[model samples]
Target: FLNKGFNVVDSSVATGKIEVSNAYKIADLTDAGAISVGKQLGAEVIVKGKALAKEGPRNTGSKVGSYIADITASALRVDNGAVLGSARGHGVSRNISEVTGGTEALEKAAREASGKIIDQIIAKWSGEVSGGGLIQLTVRGIGEYSDFVKFKDIIQGQIRGVQAIYQRSLEGGIAVLDVEMKGNAQQLSDEIARKNFGGIPVKVIGASANTVEVSLGGAVSAKTMSTPPSSPPAAQPSPPVPAAQETSSFFEADEYLVFSGDRDENGRVGKMVTRPTATNPEGEFLMYHDGQKVWSKFFKAVRSAAASELQLGSRIYFFEGNHKEGVYYSPKDKSEARLESWWRDPVTDNSLVNNRGIVTVGRYRVDVSNAFVEKK
Candidate 1:
């Protein structure tokens, strides 16, 4: 959920700590137990979930068994023991193996439930903000006590709709503030991103529905980087871009390949296609020959590509382009691929376009000379 802008606690770390403490059974944990565990893990919210799976049907001739799974999840605010929201999902799968089918069904259900629960939480937070509620601000890079005091003053005096600020804790240049504001954390973050506090550079690093994380460019020499006090100019802040996180996408065996051609000297003959998988949301190049995947490599896109790029039809195709160094296709044979889309990078504020004829898996090059362009 980092892409959604919340600082998520690692699940493995919390699980390991809970396992060692002999805490309440995860499946049957109470609200009190959840709050205790959340406090121990320094988490503001705790998400609890359960899954149930059952075999539905069996086709003996085809050796395909059907399984159904149901998943339910809820988010709890640890401080108040309040239920933010809950969601449920169902999934069905058919597989030759019973265990595999059940597992797949459960995974699908979990993904659906997780997404809905996250959406609910964000909606709830937005409502709370509109009603004038509390928001948490994590400020870092404070050079001294004076710097933090000045920062707090700026928030209270300059920012609109700020009711009050309560200092939760401050240690090692990091301070957590409980802010009572009429506006949401995202709005506050965006406003802060555009300001320069007395020539102290500020950046909004992370922001969510209820929380914002900011860093000040202060440590060694703040005055050295400061401009004249009389000539202060406002700068348009670059929007934040969410970094890549780990995710997995399920693909069936009958997945289609987009473009293929004759084998090169390395015996790598196949169609090259792009897929935006969970692991590589940017995109990856997959090569397949005779309906079998030969190799796959990640592709650097101008921006995040759409998951629709992996459609199981002839929507993907090779286009004619001039052959260049580090590219696999040439115009002479008319076997090149180009992405004819453009997107603006929020962080860099730059227009990016992806038009490539390159196809390589590590040190090996794949031939695409005889490939023909086809689109559905």
Candidate 2:
């Protein structure tokens, strides 16, 4: 749901399992362990959801099988346990995959419900949903596939009001949408500032009391994010080992994914991390500082490489993670070092994509001989 500008953290089975008996249960973060989760993942807000399509009996519809998916969810601010929004919605799908067992209906339903949940969050944070109508919306930059669909869904399904959406034009990567909403233009702008429809984030440049104008670099506001100005609580750099709270941030991070392997010769461990924000967003970016962070695992692993192939200790960056998992780098030699790991193929029946016949695929990473040509 947060694949857009919102950080996609991995609480990783840590939030535990929240099961409901075929009813929408409003989750209470206070008792559901919200603080531990907040500290674990440096998230501004958290959205929790689930689907129950296979609970009863097998689908008995068409050849592909008919499935109904219902999703109920709520949001919370990590810094302070404050419930932001809660909602439930359902969707119907006939694209059930028996060969690979992927729930298309459930995913469809969840997205439908999640979009509504986000609307509520925006309403709560920006204080707008109830009063708005006929606002001009101009979105430019990053008009990708995901953005188009999500924007369409939001306009079509406003929680309270929004009678019609008239498309003015879509040209030169700029889209002009006329939202027949009930609130004022400023209210609409404030609400748009908080949303990350699908994976596209649009910025509200300025909104007249009468008309709202939004651009694309992904609109963002701390109030809507639920993260106070003092989020992530910068830690002191004295101790090599971080406090328990700091440790959770690393495990919960969605910005840079960190992986661990056996310890290096110098008591260090191999770790691979990626900075999703710095990447090209349009293409795969696999380099340090530019769009990737390699120090923790890349440099440490290379530091322990045969004959110090990376020539360890050229320039060390004050790594983002804790001290022990810190990264070191040398621009000249760091780019050439290769690494390998496992990856899971998507749940699909296509043998071409799932040749291994299972999710886990071993020996994935390989070092390219040529250096990356930096894009201007």
Candidate 3:
């Protein structure tokens, strides 16, 4: 009797190799049940089959009967519900030999059926990968649906260069986010690092020119290599403040910060500075009417809030009202500029929504909205 069962077995030959599992009865391939088994089997693609064996018409009244088998199967991508293509196989007994030739016919039919389906799977995968620069990015440590939601939010908000996020899959407690980013892998990883995700610590563990792996709740190591620190920057004199420049006691500890548009001295158009102790900025305001020398006078307490972000050094930094853009810190010495914000903005409002702007940095933030008083 012909073995009328669906066999998904991998075969090996001197010329080729494939890793397939034992055949399965189509009735047991329930949608949910098949997915679970497929995951355990590490199946890259799934194949479904249907076939039939019948007596060949040529089996005219001869004592030996001829048999033919026709088989077909469909291939599908595991992660996405993408249908690759359908493949079919046909087989006929070479010569009626034993009590029945259907067994041989079925065997031939099964081999051809599997070969065609596997080919369809390979072609579909090749098209997906080599066509539109689609990359397979996997982010691990995503245990639940809510985590996926947050991860999606962070990716869309923090990554600006991504053209699209085509698919997201949760498997083996790992979440895979497939996206097409504009630059190579390293560039994409760096861009993702610049933005704050608020909760989980994200690290780019593996990256190639295309494929990338993002790990959640992981710490990124600091780069050890460095250029010899340039001989200490040459000593430069501080900019000259107007004789009538206001001074404030708040800056007694050198807590003062200065900001100017361009290199200093005299007629620079956007020149501005903050004198933390300045009680009144009227004199400096009239000097450069475009509101230079903002000082600490403009800051009025809108609200007092604490930070709940993971990257912020301390839970302090009162969050000034939400200003998407942070003011530039123009120090006389062009060392790496760092902003130490004292107030923190509660992220429950989704403050870190985009990649281009700074949500929070350092340990201090001034009331930016209130910090600027237009020269009314």
Best by lDDT: 1
Q: Model 3: per-residue lDDT, tens digit, 185-298?
A: 666778767767777677777765446777766323222222322432122124334344222212122222322222211121112233334555522211111111222232
Stretches of model 3 off by over 4 angstroms after superposition = 1-28, 58-60, 77-83, 98-100, 132-161, 166-200, 203-376
- Residues 1-376, candidate 2, lDDT per residue (tens digit)? 5554555766665446433333333332221455355546656677754445643246566456556666555575554333455555566665446422336667777777788667756765454345443455766653353555456566556423555565656555566666756665666676676765655666667655445666554332211212222421121112122122211211211122223222211111122233223533221212221112123331221111121121212111111111111111212232222111111111222122223221111211112111011111
Off by over 4 Å in 2: 1-4, 12-31, 55-62, 99-102, 128-376
Between candidates 2 and 3, the one scoring higher on lDDT is: 3
Which is the better candidate, 1 or 3, if ranked by lDDT?
Answer: 1
Off by over 4 Å in 1: 17-23, 134-376
lDDT of 3 at 231: 36
- Choose the strongest candidate by TM-score: 1
